[model samples]
Target: MDERIKEFFSWSDLFDYMVTRQLSHIRGNWELTWDHAAQEYEAEEDSYAELINRLVIELSELDPPLKYHDNEDRLAEYCKANLNWNIHKIGARWVGSDYASILEQGGFRDVNAGDLCLAACGRVKAALDRNQLHFDDMEEFHRKMLADVVAIILYHRSDQCITKLS
Candidate 1:
């Protein structure tokens, strides 16, 4: 295993690298939506999605030598970073809480939960692409789990749990 590849094997390390390199760009370019009641701004529709897409594309296009030498650490890092961004930033921003609370509501978790969950699905899809993990090859149970998670996020968003705060 190449030394570089050995370094990226830990998803946490990759996530840190990605955050250091990319978070500034994401924060700078993202459009802010106004929340009248909160008198604050948040990411606008599809902004998060676009950011994720760009990151995935850029990461995917990197020279294989830089991305990884042998192990799939690059792909795993991509997955974990995407998930962390959605769950920690986008989700928390929208939901005002975490998945546990949202789940206890007896319906959708909340707006944030929905946002994060949807983003998670997108990240998962990107991971599949990066790692060449085939959806077709996944067990039915795994597929269903992914679908359920995505559905919960969509449901939360659809339920209007994410209010304009006005």
Candidate 2:
């Protein structure tokens, strides 16, 4: 019912799927892993962008529109600038959910399937070492990356929800 909850649940298969990617990579099938993520993005185009755009508008208009709010414009620009390049391009491979953090780290490196698989190895190791099976990093990655992807993949499907943004 809640928008954030809906977003959270939208990627219910993320963790396990990441794990699956890890195993496949171990088996020397890294391309398969990247392909899965790429397909997911192909399925994404413009849908999630519309969702976030609406959210920014809704939140900004809570009280007759906030004074210092141009979230809509900013989001639009974000979509235009970031999403313009399709992930399906030659060097635009899926670099796992962790690549999402590279922005905050000021490390603008391109993450590929190998990087994702290696990160998977680390997460898997952490789980085996009794760390909390956390997806915080991945979740943050989803927020930034998916929004960017959707924004780039423009479409007019404005009134639909992948699940329900209610």
Instruction: State each model's CA lDDT, in order.
Output: 0.34, 0.29
Alpha-carbon shift of residue 137 in model 1 (angstroms): 3.0
Over 4 Å off, model 2: 1-111, 131-166
- Itemize residue pairs with steric clashes in candidate 1: 94-112, 95-112, 102-109
lDDT of 1 by residue, 11-114 (tens): 23122232223333433333324334543233344233233323333333333332221122222233335434232335223233443233324232233542
Best-performing candidate as measured by TM-score: 1
For candidate 2, give the lDDT of residue 124. Answer: 27
Candidate RMSDs in order: 17.4, 19.6
Q: Candidate 1 — worst ten consecutive residues by lDDT sum?
A: 66-75
What TM-score would you give candidate 1 relative to the actual structure?
Answer: 0.26
- Which pairs of residues collide in candidate 2? 83-152
Q: Per-residue lDDT for 11-69 in model 2, tens only?
A: 33343244223333222221211123422211223224233334323322332223111
